[model samples]
Target: MTRRLLVSYLTLAALVLLCLELPLGYVYSRAERERATNAAHEEAEAIAGYASLTLAYQHPDELSAQVTACAERIGGRVLVVDPAGALLATSHPLDAADQAALADRPEIAAALRGGNGADVRTSSIGGVNWLSVAVPVRHGATLQGAVRLIVPTGAIADDVHQVWLGLALGGAGVLVAVGTVAATLARWIGRPIRELERAARTLAGGSLTTPASVTTGPPEVRVLAATFNRTAALLEHLLASQSAFAGEASHQLKTPLAALRLRLDNLEPDVPPHLRGHLDAAMTETDRLARMVESLLALARMEETALTPEPVDLDRAAKDRVHAWGALYERHGVRLLLLGAPVGRALAVPGAVEQILDNLLSNSLRVAPAGSTVTVFRRLSGISAELHVADQGPGMTAEQRRRAFDRFWRAPDAPKGGTGLGLSLVQRLTLASGGEAVLLEAPGGGLEAVIRLQTLTPRHPGGFPLPLPRRRPMAGSKAGAGVGAG
Candidate 1:
């Protein structure tokens, strides 16, 4: 954009310089030609004074000498013509063809008819073009003949060429000067806009503190910057308010839910067997409500918290999360397996990797069939690390996976226990940590949740080698687990 702006400014500057310089150059050349012609005319008139006496008295010798002296002074040709348009004397020796042509010249004929005349025509000497001025030599009103002074037009053209060269140099200097100033001005204007673009992108990437600065540029650009700052401020305020409200509402809901669950548990001991099932269902609903509220609270906190990128031991994080859910997996008759070696550190916000893994593992354990393998794995990519949780369960279709990240959106055949916020929370948390979360079809018809995070620079020289962990199936399991090295 700055390049385009600078080019446009230079183009305009060059055009304006051309418009002014071209006509001025032409005018200077024309004036020089006219000055040369007028000077020739004046010289011709002065020579005619001396020639008139010789022509009137029929003295060819004196007239020829005077005409020769005039031609030498002007470095041109001179001729004396009689009233009948016949050449009487010449400045230099000429052939009969040239002498006859001189008498028949247009300006000489006009001069013999008792009139001063001037013309531009080819010279007889070298076939070069010349500006000729002819004046009639009159002795007290009787026209004796004409005296012609001819100067080569090449001299005038030479002078014009020099002047034009100066004009071109001067115009180029002006264009360069103006172009430099225009480029500076373009940078002055474009810098602010470029900065604004960067600030806008940063703000969109969850940094509300970044606002377009109003400084330098035209009045209109400054005004636009001010407007952008105001809009950003408004957006920041609205997001803060929403985050505050979600946190406040979730907290308010959680307290009542916990109190109600405590009261339900207290009533369970006094309840009969027929009503116990209903009470248990009520407790389950309360637990689901509690989980939903916690999820909402987590979402709210994610929006409010600013993520500072940091290096995390993703291998350790995945192993810890999978180990933490080991008891839960045993209760469900599902095999929890940790595959792949421990990967190097991944770049993410604090607690983001843990939260994402926890959500994925919890969801997988809930849906994974009996004796099915629930695998938590780590894979290394170039400058990135991928953490994956694959479950051998009734996985969703492509469309369901796409919409899985939407809050409160569940598949039609989704199990009864989920609040549908697990994947949504995972997605939001991954994005907040400057990572991406995606769902893929695992091998053998299972759903795989993959989180790709940036890898951090190594802390030690040559880096520490990470050893792969062996996969161990659950104790007393009939089916063995599948673990792939990555």
Candidate 2:
């Protein structure tokens, strides 16, 4: 992780430097060229002025000598060119090879055309970057001739070169500083996360008591750590609860089972018919207690688990489950009716929605009379899509609805045979999906299980859970053991 951070820092700094360097480099190069040309041009203008004075048609010799001396002070050579392109005088080397090289000078030709000119080229005699400039020399209203000057551009090149070197050194220092800071900051930010990751791994490896080492940082990180620590505490408590429950279950369950065994043992000495029946009932009650413990454990497992949820369409999920159980419903003479069409979308965990529907359907199948209707309907209320399962079986009184979502709750009117864990699982799944589940009496005198959920739609995105009916009255009683909401 540290290595990754370093690489990221380095990559970012390089990209910034590359983005900044090229344009500034071009500007520096251009500025250097301009300065060299301007120096030569300034010298040319002075020499041009001196030549104008020499056009005196008198004292031309004196004027020429003055121009040559002025040119020397600035470390350059001057030339006087006639309008006819003839060189009248020059401070250039007068040797044969040097004079012959003067014919190829572009500045000299430009001055003959009555314009100022400047250029940088390798000098044949000096063997260096030579800056040259030419100016149109005039007298009164008539064009007299032109004066040209040459100076070495090595000084300008040296200054620009030094500037470029300084830029290189400065950029290198800045990049290093930036890289150091970036590395430090990335580590500072990433450290707590790394610590948290290690803590989580320890927990995953079955060390739930492992303490998080992240003491402090930003507020958000500290909050996250606090949450982690609290969750760990809760998990430890739950595990302790499970352990305690296991021991209690063993102790409590053995008594009923032992009694049933004793009752059977006594059956060997010519037991009466009624005595046999009582023994059978005792054994049945023991079996029911065992089944209840098992169902309670299943509910506890579902309650303790945390699973990642994905988007699911509750309507589609209900339809598929109903169809799967349709044949069974028909075989039992219960008419399964899907009353309202599915709304096509809901955001829920895939299997969780199906599980919720299964719980509702199972309850409906249990208490529903032969030839009665078990109806499933979808309704849009506010922003929520609701699935309502109504059965013609006896409806719960308001008191029963209030306690219906509680674990191990079996309504008074429900049959006595079922181990109630289905509704508890439904409640857990509803909370997991950011939704709500409730058991209420349908308008048509049967149990109605309503599940409200937020919708996920392209055109209409989501909805809010509305206020449910709060006050519940007492439940009614019935005969025969039936499946009730847990």
Candidate 3:
């Protein structure tokens, strides 16, 4: 921002300098050239008067000597010609071809015709630029001869160049001054805003105490800082209140629910056989209510916590969870398998991968039928590591999948004991770790829950890594055969 501001100031300064100095330079150059032309013309006219007297008296020697001295004084060449356009004397001697060409020259011809002539042109001989002036000699209305003076234009060009150089130097100096001022101004304006930005990030990162400085920048920025502080304080207060309410509610509800379950169990022994069904139904309802309360509390806790992401070995986590859930799957007569090879580490919030996997596996186990396979796998997709838990159970439709992450939302045909908060928890944990969770249709008919998390290296989409050649037995479990790499 500072660099941009400085460049903007310099650009504006350069434009202003161009507008002011370009015309000034052009006008000065034209004035200098005009002044030189006029001076040469006046001097040429004076020499023409001397030539008139020299020609009328027929003193060629004196005319030659005078022309030579006049050329030396002015650092130019001088020429005197008769009325018929014949060159009589020259300050500088010329070859036969040059002397022959002088009579037909435009300025000299014009002077012999009783008119003054002046022109600036490039010399055909050496490609040098010259300013030439010619004036006729008159002795009381009788033309005796003409005088022509030629000077190089390099001196005039040198003066104009110096002026342009000075203007450029002045513009450069102005840009430097503007850059320094702009940098100072940018810092003055941007410092408080930067502090405000840092404060905002800190608040988002779960630090509610830090506030932007309100005394440093411009008045508008100070006001913004003050407003940010007020807003942050209010948000912090609101979250604190919410957390307190959740904690208090959890404490107040769990004890009563436990006592109610205990009392229902106590009544089961006293109730007769016919009323036992009614008692059992009551207990079931109570259990479902307790699960709902637990789910709600878990969601509340998750919302209040802000966890930073860290690297975890995705392949190792998947294997560990599959091993843990193997016995449960065997008890239901369903196969739990870990597919794919070992993918590298992925970035996720601490304990987030474990919690997300637990919820997904629980959901899959609930919906999976006897003799059906529940597969867990990890693969690399682009720069993300993907973990998929697929179950051979009834899959949801597009509409159900779209709303699956909503809190307490369940499909119409979902299992009876579900609290409908598992998917929601999975999605929340994934997003908090800067990842994504989605329900995709599994191949050969079922639901596939895919979680994508960040990885340090990029990977191309390809076939899954080769599974292990032999099955490895799980510890303290006879269901090892049901849990092999696919």
Q: Which stretches of candidate 2 lie over 4 Å from their true place?
A: 1-28, 55-77, 93-106, 120-130, 152-154, 213-215, 268-270, 273-486
Supply the TM-score for candidate 3.
Answer: 0.88
Best by lDDT: 3
Q: Model-by-model lDDT, in order?
A: 0.79, 0.72, 0.82
Q: Kindly list the per-residue Cα lDDT of model 2 for residues 158-198, writing each as its tens digit.
A: 88788778777877887889878978877876777777888
Per-residue alpha-carbon lDDT of model 3 for 409-465, expressed as tens digits?
A: 777777766777778878888998899998877766677788999887646556343
Could you tell me every candidate's TM-score relative to the true structure?
Answer: 0.71, 0.51, 0.88
| Poorest lDDT segment (10 consecutive residues) of candidate 2 | 466-475
Candidate 2 TM-score versus the reference:
0.51
Clashing pairs in 1: none
Model 1 Cα lDDT, one tens digit per residue, 387-486:
8788777677777777788888777766666787888888887887788998876766667788888777533344443333333333332221111100
How many Å off is the CA of 270 in candidate 3?
2.1
Where's the lowest-lDDT run of ten residues in candidate 1?
Answer: 477-486
